[model samples]
Target: MLYALGDPVSLVLLLLSFVVAVTLHGWVQCLVASRSGLRGPAAEGRTRPDPRRHVDPFGAVSAAIAGIGWAKPVDPPDRRNRGALLRVLLSGAVANVVVGLGALALLPLLTSSVGSLVTFLGPSRLLQSGIEGDLAARALLFLGLANLMTGLLSLVPIPPLDGGRLLFGLAPRSPGWQKAEYQLDERNIGVAVLLALMLIPLGGPQALLPTILDTLAGPLVRLVTGA
Candidate 1:
């Protein structure tokens, strides 16, 4: 029962951090879209910091279950500007990474002790400690790690993901690329592929999603925090 209950405070912080990251991610995309001359929903106030403006119900649930998820999709006013589309697509991922780095930078202010830093970084300790360190410290660590992982995950090349869209924007208008894009759109296979990757274990005890997050985001977190 204790295991199930498990650090309600940390859970709250984690959720809050995730919401903030997602909100920033969406808002940045909206801002970029509008600035790129593709004004639409974002221009009309969908870019608000409120999570409601950007949260996708399925994406939120996925983030809670997995370590990474997406936000509500931002539509372009038109496909007329390839450069604008690329910028809009990439902005959200950049926002997440920036947020993650910012959170890491703020960690020292919360708790400067090396022990607390180690405790947060250590995998076994991270899961076992729950909300052990200073509230602000732990919260910032959670936010940093969450944002970093989500940002990197968004860069995975698959349809519907930011990286995939960026790739599409860069691809030449050759018939082959167009056919591939059309196939991806028609079958909607990327989401399935992404889910499969997220669910399957990565040749070890750990699941793929968390493992990837830890492997990629962990080092970056350490580098930024100097832990």
Candidate 2:
């Protein structure tokens, strides 16, 4: 819904946030892979934080609508080191978490600066009062909270997601683990299951996508807001 005509301000904020989140995620993955001695696609040029180098088309659109999206996968070079693989797989998620926290920490500053701007401009008294009220504050809060929720949602363990790769890296190469990997392949039914969870509406006023992100991000958002 990036082009949706409703609520342009919020849509733009969320679109920008999603872009930054995915860029950070891809760059971190490439960095980790490069450091792990794999000069693969990510290490070559995908580490530049450019959308063309990292963002998948469907993934980006889905993210704009669902609040959680992914970037193109960066395959690591042939290496038998499980630890290195784990690091590469987990780096993207770590980057998202870091970005989300940084955004949260900036919320108060953003609102305060907006206040200062309004005061300096000597806006109408009514306008000043409204700005000092919840509008700007809520906007900043939503920006922060949206990024946090998106990052957390990216950590859901399903095929082709970072969390799924994390699990594969962590598990030993046993029969069960191999079976799980096979079943969780990118082209398998796992992707369908994930999409269903994201697209389905369970109850009033909210779909499963936002509901899940909210549930996962609730505690962390509270901690960040000191709520």
Task: Compute each candidate's TM-score over C-alphas.
Answer: 0.81, 0.75
Clashing pairs in 2: none
- What is the C-alpha lDDT profile of model 1 across 1-227, one tens digit per residue? 01213778876766776687778888888888877776685556875777889877656755665545677767744445777877888788888898888878778666665334544553222422345657777777767766776678777766667777667667788999888777664476766677667656678654665565566666676677676
Judge candidate 1 at residue 33 and give its lDDT: 81
Residue-level error in angstroms, candidate 2, position 70: 2.1
RMSD of each: 3.7, 7.7
Instruction: For residues 19-46, write the lDDT of model 2, one tens digit per residue.
Output: 7667777788888888887777543597
> Whole-model Cα lDDT per candidate?
0.67, 0.60
Model 1, position 196, has a per-residue lDDT of 69
Question: Which candidate tops lDDT?
Answer: 1
